[model samples]
Target chain A: MAEPGREIPKPTPETQHFWDGCKQGELLLQTCKSCDHTYFPPRPFCPDCGHREVAVVKATGRARLFSYIINHLPTPGFEVPFAIAVVELDEGPRMMANILECEQTPEALVLDMPLEVTFQPVSDDISLPQFKPASQSTGSGSA
Target chain B: MGQKTVAIVGAAETTELGKIPHMSQIQLHADAALNALADAGLTIKDIDGVATAAHNPVELAHYLGITPTWADGTSVGGCSFMLHVRHAMAAIEAGLCTTVLITHGESGRSWVGRHGPSLFPSELQMQFERPFGVSRPPNMFTIPVLRYMKDHDLSVETLAMVSVIQREWAAKNPRASFKDPITVDDVLNSKMIAYPFRLLMCCLVTDGGGALILTKADRAKDFPTKPVYILGSGESVESPMISQMADFTSSRAFKVSGTKAFETSGISHADVDHLMIYDAFAHLPIYGLEDLGFVKPGEAGDFIAERNTAPGGTLPLNTNGGGLSYMHSGMYGMYALQEGVRQMRGIAPAQVEGAEISVVHGVGGMFSASGTIVLTNSE
Candidate 1:
């Protein structure tokens, strides 16, 4: 699961759909049919009401800035000054995605800021679903 | 049955929190052990009992320069310390040993190379959740909170109130990582780290060392000015793996442990004045309040926010500051017992008023293992 330039864990069968969707440039989640409650990582069963029927759905790809950290540690392949956010997907599930394309500071990470999903192609097969300001679009500068 | 009362006589700690790369975990545990023995008015040579949770067994005893005839390390993670305290009390009352020492230290934060190759043990790591990019503690916790919101028909506003209450509690203690006054609005509007959880709800990632000493009730009185008594104890592990748990929405271990502890102490939750439930994440206390029977199952979010668990509130809790504001050392269970002792002695700076009886509970490995100890002033 080593992407030539990336050092993240490889996705397995249970998590492949999530990675595949990210590869296709979409944010996805699993919803339980019995309870109709949305969840993350697309589990095999409805976590609520003990139902086995679950379905995959594209998220509105819209999220609210839930909470975040201003990391100063210099890890290779990742920006030292990066903002990692837990985004509240419009569908009800919350996912951990980084907030990119914005000032990498505390001021840029106000709670409830509107955001849109963006993917970073770590390896050819896997692209992590990160987010950035909704007003922003796909441009080149990363850091 | 000889004497059903026990209390902490000493507590000690080392400063290697967050990232300590220079020494083995054993060496770090030793430093804290020596400090605690000194605090208890005893030397390492005087300690004949050793207890720990999930260690390499002789690692702690060998490092401390004392090999007790009795040794135990149950390794339940953060909750291990409180469980060790209860075990020490039982061993002392049975005359198995005198002057026991408990310790823990781990470089969990720094030892593992992120992205390169995770050094975290395969069995111990979050195998089920981490692969989907849900590697952090705050993310896993968000799921339960989402369900709690549904079960109670509560708004996100209810959860926001918890951050403010804990921030206020943290403000009173210098040890907490966050001390400024935060508001419900600030928390609700704050950045989401995970759905249903905000930045303020997460415990700061810290790696540190802590140790405590226990002696026979009479031996405790001989040295320390106020040796707190351990009134009652209880422990139960419902599920080994978090994902396999039957009820992810509510914690079963906390409920069982709290109920058993209340029964062991011959009193109800109503008799308890100070409540120190683990706050590994902010939602922990919310789940804890319900499990410990303080509030109904779905009332924790609101119960905590209305000042029900603050310094001057009805349940005045976690006076030394919790993992939320204080230190989130690898194993903080023992420190919880130490805080209980301090509160009962009226020595805590954030002391709950008239605190004679306190209920201290610990949650280990997410919501898997739970333990409780009731400590009170010597009657």
Candidate 2:
């Protein structure tokens, strides 16, 4: 089976720092230095105020499952019945990720459940940020 | 606001719908254009304006051997054609063009000479969405379905009824790709493409195209076919990304477009005898109903589940079976617009008796964009 992170996104000048942070086991996000506004899929300017002054800050790596779908369709490097979840970050934005370490079923994956970030190295050059139930303590570091 | 001056004088689909492996995507556009021209009893020379979705107007005009003073290539996804109709109305009113022809064609199933937009790794969709293993439409669309269901207290069975009701309409049309009636159980049991969306709840992958001709109402009598007057039309865009939608329970684009059309047309929902909400997926109509003010929020599920939109119901919906059972040529808006013109002309196969006014609405992406057109047989 292909690994879950089959397609590694090519980092552009704007988003290179985000990928670099993942490789170092840190979840880095951009915040506007002028407005103190944080955002994801990093850009140089603040999306809210269009300020050029921005800073990269380490995230709390805490989030909750906002919504998701159990996809039966086969995707590259993934099996069927996988959960495609939307996680609401503690910093107030949402991002998509695949949930791991839990059975991919409705009974187990509840909405608004606590989740924490776990980086999985899909390639020697890239490590993907994935999520799992926050209750699991071990293997919390880079996998 | 002078909406009654524009009318649809010509409308037709490709020579063969559902599947046409022999014809390329561009060829389908040419065929549908010729058929519409013939239906209007006019030659290509009569067209002064042209619009299309997916295919380029420059190529379409060149292929059809016509020169248009005004051309529109609004590629907003499936609802692109609806916007074309609205733009054609404005162009005609502003004297930019007199007679307009709008065409749509796609070889979704065959992939013959298909050259579509690509989502590169640097694109926002690839950078954020694709990384999450969100495979395709069924996967991406699910971002809203679960939340809508929870907000509305809608059961899975209520959503499946959308397919069952559309199939009921499909059974009456001979050209429908899937005519056999299917029960809600049949829909629920179909292989799940995504949670809350079974195979039946999803639209079909077929190859086809449709065309429309518009002219000033003063010239309506010159056409061979009866005119379907443009009562009102509206179009709007939310966000290109589905995740950025303002509300998961409702489509703001749908609400804005539908409200604008209704206000411009000055027609109440009670007067609409027929309706078509783009049914790319079963949940679309449910969203359309609430957003259009035809039903209250969290009530469209029960409204459809109680047989209000089924055949012989007070308000006929998707009288042509819709994308669920009729045909989805990738961009399904053209088919919906064709059915609207057909009903106004009083010649649809599943014709709604004494149908005077029809409202056709379409969604471009997964609630990313929307357009609404209101039509009437009377001047």
Candidate 3:
């Protein structure tokens, strides 16, 4: 069927952890101990080293603002004029995330700007992970 | 082990794409099939096999009126139907079947619409990515595109150049969605669909049906249609989903798919007279150019600006206006094949003169699934 409205897909057992971390305002990536390869969208095994010994690691939550957009037209479920980004996470997974606490424009945003993870509550079962300019979260607001 | 010479003897289509709310999916399929049969001057009874794509294959068989000696519903993104041509060639050479009709019919934009089940991973892809407002393909693909821009030092204006040129090429095509004039400023100023990406930078959602008829080279001459021989074809799947991708800078499947196609066709980049790339979005052609070795990695944006992919330009690309302009029809790959066949036959609206060789590339997924087909008419 043609998607009628803004429909968000639900997380399954395999992806619950990733979603959970986002709910709590943390960016978490799965790392496999067998070969030490980290990845996003959480998988069951180490795709590269082929190991099953994997665990969720608290990401440094630090990232570089690789790219982003400020959307104007809102999907049925989303607010309009929100910011989105492809954050290069410290754990090695470059994730598609939202950038909150800032205007959605090239002038206010700079490439490779340091960013840190934050959370926005969306629903009872869903909490979302967004990023803020790293300086704001650090309190010093410099460098 | 060696190459083959299969040609396009038939082509067909139905009405406009999206939400007709009138005809059943099978009716659309049959209409395209019937048109192809007429295009090739052949009858349904002349075919020995059928290939189906989109929502349901068995349903297609039920509606088509007759069963084939060989049947396929191989679904790979939209371009999969074109990949079927190569498989059909192999099957024909193996004496399994002849006169294969490969088709796809879907209307995901509006009435009588269809989208195959999200297939588990995408369900999670939508969930984990969206609530944070990482919704839709433009947002999903932005991160990698960002990485591409940063690592390569590509400016947003450079990226905009790709779509702008494509829109210009699409202007000649009556089937295209955004034939209106567009400028780099227009693309830059356009509202953002995702970060650093705007509406003009994306492809439109259209609804329609398309078909291709192929058979042995010897039998093709007898067919009423002009034959555009299929030289080589290849397919590849690098990742199941975008989230699973390790690198954001390049598409491994595109590289590998083109490699396989060139091997099968025994043609090189130099042999190509035109390139009918699948441009689901502007970046797609850029990726195809790099992945298929038309340009060095990170050089496509510059190539588009400095080179001519437009009419009267050095490069005769997407003469039918491409997917960016041509009907999106769910899978733009099928239409690309149609354009390639037309170009080789010298019958396209914006025909590429003396164009004997062409390359039609199709990508599925988010740089995750890809296929490449090389075609020529040396004879």
Candidate 4:
């Protein structure tokens, strides 16, 4: 469900496939075919090796809390005291997202804690990628 | 130290800072420009080059009735003004223009003739980060500090000390927005704007602007005001997205910029008597100190805690009370440059006696961009 007043991302030609993957419950990443370099936020060319040939890969949806802040002020559609976090995907890229299913405190949102990606559909064309604590059954991979 | 020496012959802030509902943004720029012109005994007709950020240089030139042969509208973020000074120095050296005027103005608080946030849906920040509820600077800029603290074993009290010591400097400056003294407890107990960042740790939202006039060192003596020579300067950018910053604990942009400035200036850390690191947030100075090689990594918090940067300390920092207590009209790089000039001229309210060399460092956006300038009163 889309949160009222929250911004909806409009996809560009390069990022359309990534957004398309999100709508179908998959997190997509781009990898360079020439240099085998991986990157995010969807660009046509590889940033590392400047290669034109790239491949789209599925992210494991598993991540770890890298860093964050518990914002107390209210913004457009966000409730006060929410955790604005940066999570490191197991594949090596880090992205910003909001933490869910946890208390908005340093004690609860410990750094390096295990997390898993969960998509929240904000619009028909866009679905925001968020994170939540990894379940007990989800075996540890990296932290 | 180029072929031609460039010096700042005039520098002044707006007639009034904090709040000015009567003046629009461009008017604030004009007011500061006129004040600086009057200080240097020059006029708009005398200026052959112009530079500014946020607002277009062409618009500013037209607004001020200056038909400049050279103009720069390099707007990166808050540190845009620092880049302006660096660019102006090179322009003057290359004989691109005889005299250069760099102006900065923003309606951060009063919203006088200011545009609202223009968030493009296709922009990287808007597309990836904004949807996650990272709204304002306090939330975004403060995100990496916790990781820094955790790595350094820095306590919250040490972080609060940054606000406390800067407040002490602000107490000395009558023009500072908040003059009252504050304790570490006070900062800790203040309203929580973001985790690990209290209200006092954040910069003030005010409306103001400043301007600088630079000319060849040979013509610098013709001005009424003393000249502060630009010895060296450097600028660099890392990443626009805060999450993608090379490292959460330190800024890659700060390191590159500071290193280049030091290399160009050929000055050692011990030679610097005064420093001005843009304190948009408390952690910036800590990062600035380490990245600038003033101190080792993970030691800035303790260095600040031990009163190394306070009044009567070995090294003075943010002598203008900084953005935390001083006025912050969005782009804070102008104010930092203004204070550096003041220190060089021996006229700052909290002046460092016989301070010959001053280094001013600034950060734009969320550690996304950086610029450093080395200023000296001695030729």
TM-score list, all predictions:
0.70, 0.94, 0.88, 0.98
Interface RMSD, in order shown: 7.3, 1.3, 3.3, 0.8
DockQ of 1: 0.06
Tens digits of per-residue lDDT, candidate 2, A1-143, equal: 23854676777888889989998999988899999999876889998899999999998788887778899888887888888887777887777788888899988888777889888787776777888888656322322
Off by over 4 Å in 3: A1-11, A16-27, A136-143, B15-24, B113-121, B174-182, B185-192, B240-244
The C-alpha local distance difference test score for the whole of candidate 2 amounts to 0.87
lDDT for model 3: 0.73
Ordered by DockQ, highest first, the candidates read: 4, 2, 3, 1
**Which regions of candidate 1 fall more than 4 Å away from where they truly are?**
A1-143, B1-5, B15-24, B107-128
Best by lDDT: 4
In terms of lDDT, the poorest run of 10 residues in model 4 chain A is A134-143
TM-score of chain B of 4: 0.98
DockQ of each: 0.06, 0.60, 0.41, 0.87
Root-mean-square deviation of candidate 3 = 3.9
Global lDDT scores for all candidate models: 0.69, 0.87, 0.73, 0.90
- Residue A141 lDDT, candidate 2, scale 0-100: 33
Docking class of 3: acceptable
Best by DockQ, which number?
Answer: 4
Please rank every candidate by lDDT, starting with the best: 4, 2, 3, 1
